[model samples]
Target chain A: MRHARIIFDGRELDIDIDANDRITTSEGEVLDVALDSDQITWLPPVKEPGTIFALGINYADHATELAFEPPKEPLIFIKHANTLTGHKQVSYRPDGIEYQHYECELVAVIGKSGKNIKREDALDYVAGYTVCNDFAIRDYLENYYRPNLRVKSRDSLLPMGPWIVDTADIPNANALKLTTTVNGKLTQDGSTKDMIFDVPFVIEYLSKVMTLNPGDMICTGTPHGIVDCQPGDTIVCTIEDICSLETRMVSEQEYYGDKY
Target chain B: MTANTLVNSKLVCVALNDKAQLAALDATFNEAPYKKPPTQPVLYYKPRNTWSVDGAEVEWAKDFDGNDVAEMVVGASLGVVIGKETCRVSAEDALNYVAGYTIVGDFSLPEASYYRPDIKGKCLDTSAPVGPEIVAADKIANPDALTVTISVNGELKSTFELGNMERSVAELISIISRIMTLQAGEIIAVGFAGDRVAVAKGDKVEASIEGVGTLTNTLGGA
Candidate 1:
């Protein structure tokens, strides 16, 4: 079963998507509207997301590509809730900035609250999986909190959802293929199997220091093949059996107009 | 305790906002990794799991020997609470978006380097204790002129002036809002100085800002 939150006809709804891609209410009343219709606006699958944890270099190949060694422990960072936008949202590409890249990642949404969770029991805490495009502007990167919020947590930078696929459906979340495309051309291709710290280890590691609450999302880091994005580019990040999250990059001027 | 309900969103904190902290690391600014001093506000987030109310008992982190880490740094700071959705406002108008002020105790295990985000040392559960009560923004004449003091078991450990910050409360809001929108009920902790005090397990820690309430918490054995 896949679940989603959306705004249809100016009404926010908690919907479920059937295997045939039909939208239905929680009570199973099928809606006549299609997801791509103008009347519907997709929101992040999680209605009210809790803490958003992101891995910086979870993939060994990605670490090597960036000229860094694999970390001994998970290198995690937090993103504010305001950074999130839904599928088909527009993320701003700052004017005259160089090297703004998209990171396609698989996100694990926590369903249960627990501390000191063991690796073997971590899966029980996950509600489902989704996809996110963790876009970063490398030009703003600084060593003081490398990958600072300015570079990563800008508004609408993280485009997530479409919907969340249940944990039971994935069977092996670590073996899935993750891909990213720019204007319908494949730009990144990788597998979750390359993650130095898998989902269970990440969950266990984080829960050791703090409680993992429901709606807390862990964006498992992206793979290597990153290409700088442009104003008119549409980037789609997809995870097998989960979601294909789409985002359109627009100029800072276009996004804010004369407001800024 | 009721003040915790006011903070339903993220706690964004600025690093090295203190002139003293920046001065202490002035020589290293030209070094590798950081070729220049921060040109922009260095920001990080304290996740919801780290949020605890005033007077709460926070567990101390344990060492490899299963014993408690000797001490943790006390980051006494003034928290600016936002009243509305604020974005790209000027410093002159930033105060209008502020709702109130509170005391925040950003406790963390002491670390030597500031090159990376100290997730393990700073983001432990109950590491950030906010509030006794919020003092309405209008009630405080000058937040930057306030003095912040830290006490351990009723003993004065450290005292610093908020005026030492490189960025004022309004400027931080103005600058940060240029990149991200600060939602209502969220907090932005105006940074603490390098002269941080340390407290050990079983010690009662209190951080108070002039014109704002005091936030008290005790470090408990893990």
Candidate 2:
């Protein structure tokens, strides 16, 4: 089963998508809207999502690409709710900055609350999996908390989900293929198997530091191929057997329109 | 500023806002990794799991091997509660968005480096104990001039002035809001100053701001 939340006809709704791509409300009433319809605005699959934990250089190859050594422990950072936007959304590329890139990642949504969770039982706490584009502006990067909020937590920088696919649906989650395309050109390709700290390990590691609650999401880090994105670029991120997330990059001027 | 009011709020905190801290690290800031002093506000997030109410008993941090760690640092500071959705606000208008002020006891395991997000040292469960009550923003004459004091076991351990901050409260809100929209009910924990005192298990810690009430908590035995 796949779950989604959307705003249609000025009404917010909880919906489910079938294997055949049929859309229905939680009450089983069929919705006549297509996933790509301009009539409906998509919200992030999880409503009022909790703390978002993002990994930094969780892939060994990605660490090598950046000329850094693989960390002995997980390099985790927290992103706030303001950074989130849903599929088919517009994200702003700030003016006078260089090297804004998109990172394709798999996001795991926590289903159960647990503290000091063991690695073996970590999967039991996961409700579902979705996809996110962890966008960053390298120009804002500083060594003090290296992927700081200025670089990563800008408004609408993270584009998440068409919807969430149940954990049961992806039996081999660690083996899925993740890819990203910019304006129809494939820019990144990798497998979850390459993650240095896999899903179960991260869940265990985080639970030790603090409680893991329902609606919390962990965005596992991206792979190596990251290319600079520009205004007017359409980036699509997809995880095999999960979902595709689309984002259109626009200038800050276009997004704020003289408001800023 | 009841715990219920902050149940859904996100606690955003700043680092190196204390002028004394920057003065101490002035030479190091010019070296490797940092390369130069921070040009913008350095921010971090304290998630919901770390939230605890005043008078709560917080557990001591444990090592990777599961043994109790000796002491946790006390990050005593003022907390600004946002009353409205704010984005791209100006310094002069920043205070209008504040609903009230309270004390925040940002407890953490002692760690030396500021180069990475210290999730292990700072984000322990029940680490942030906030508020006995909130004093309305209008009641406080000047937020920056307030004096902050830290006490442990009834002994006054440290005292500092909020005016020593590199960035004023209004400036912090204005700069942060420019990058991200701060929702109503969210909090901004203005950073602590100078050398912070550490507390051991069974120790009672109290942090008080001049206008805002004091927040007290105890470290439970491991």
Candidate 3:
């Protein structure tokens, strides 16, 4: 069955969805739960995922455009849980950075837990899938700083969700379209096919090191064409079968003000 | 005394006082829970200077020395400790690398970080006070199911579940190990779920978890 968490009118429910992961609830049903839009908090569909990892400089096209060769292996980084925000959330603008951008990519959600799974059965471990925008504070790209607390893990930096789709629904997660729009303008237009290493490879590569939990999320690298944005920009990122994540670019003052 | 425990469950305890307040949180893993270790295992540092126990009493002052101030952190989460030597471990293999979890209070003026540009915004002596006790890893079944709430002087500031986090403890360990080496006694704090709030002097902060225990600290004035 299609699964979704939606806030309609003033109710929230884990309802069945179509391919879009949207609310399939018929009107006037009065969702079993009600929450103010402002008060409603959305979580990534996968339960307590073990990790939130990302691939760095993974797309060969992105690698070539920047004049850098792709790493011999996947270059991974962590975006602390503090950086996560679901659809219709706000992503903070760092205090000192002038540049920031959104990278849309397919997020592989692990289903079963196993280590050293062969590439042939890698797809067997995938539970479902979701979408995540690696909302980055691109300010430190020039500086040689650790991605730990700097490049990533800023306040509410990642915008994920709408929902998680069973991996089976996506015949080829690697062949989907990943797009990003900011302030209603096209900012990033890319494809998973351009990935130097596809999802199965990522899973096979990652499993050798750690056992991915059912809810854990891994972002396949974003493709080329990343555009910069500032506060007051609204970004909407969508992956083909997965859901879309919408967020507002907020400044420090706005983030720390009445909202915080 | 030996106790029965599960492999996927990791229990990290922090002890630092007469009445050590303990909290149990999950670590990602030592090995590549997802892929493989990036390179030389990293035993990152988040000294006691950066430690902050949730549910500890916090007080306000202009600065640690006395300046103009707005508010202070009450029952809250401040920082996390990264283990030094763990490698390619999974959520199931997490329990062994823990030193334990502790309860501490952190009070650093935003300016305190400016004084020392070398380190990040954290790392101040007394910046962290941990422990009420250490809970064995096997003791807690699901870290995600546990409740983490912060109260400032009897008022509830935030209430969230470890499950609320985007990433779980096991996954964090797996992912972290992939990037850097994790050593025994290292810790990774699953970030808090809500925004932090301030508490005044004489306030009491309490942090509690199901199956684990509670930690209480009085605002001593920062």
Q: Chain A alone, TM-score for each of the models?
A: 0.97, 0.97, 0.85
Full-model lDDT, candidate 1: 0.87
TM-score of model 1 vs. true structure = 0.96
What's the residue-level lDDT of B198 in candidate 1? 79
Which residue pairs show collisions in model 1?
A: none
- lDDT leader: 2
How would you encode candidate 2's per-residue C-alpha lDDT over A15-113 as one tens digit per residue? 999898889987778988777789979898888788899999999999999898999999999997889999999999999997999999999999989
Candidate 3 has an lDDT of 0.56
Which stretches of candidate 3 lie above 4 Å from their native place? A6-12, A19-42, A141-146, A258-260, B1-222
Scoring the B chain of model 1 against the true B chain gives a TM-score of: 0.93
Expressed as tens digits, the lDDT of each residue in B130-184 for candidate 1 is 8988899999988889988889999999887878889999899998898888888
Q: Classify candidate 1 by CAPRI docking class.
A: medium
Q: DockQ (Cα-based) per candidate?
A: 0.69, 0.78, 0.03
Residue A85's lDDT within candidate 2 is: 93
RMSD (Cα, Å) for all candidates, in order, is 1.8, 1.6, 18.7
- Using all chains and alpha carbons, the TM-scores for the candidates as numbered come to 0.96, 0.97, 0.54
**Candidate 3 docking band:** incorrect
Residue lDDT tens for model 2, B149-197: 9999999998879889999999999999988989887889887876888
> Once model 3 is optimally superposed onto the true structure by TM-score, how far is the C-alpha of residue B93 displaced, in angstroms?
35
Q: Candidate 3, after superposition: displacement of residue A187 in Å?
A: 2.0
lDDT of 1 by residue, A1-260 (tens): 89999988777899998888899987767899876787779898898798888999889999999999999988888887788999998999988788999999999999989987889999999999999989989998888888788888888898899899999999998899999999999999999999999889999888767778999999999998999999999999988888888899998988887775
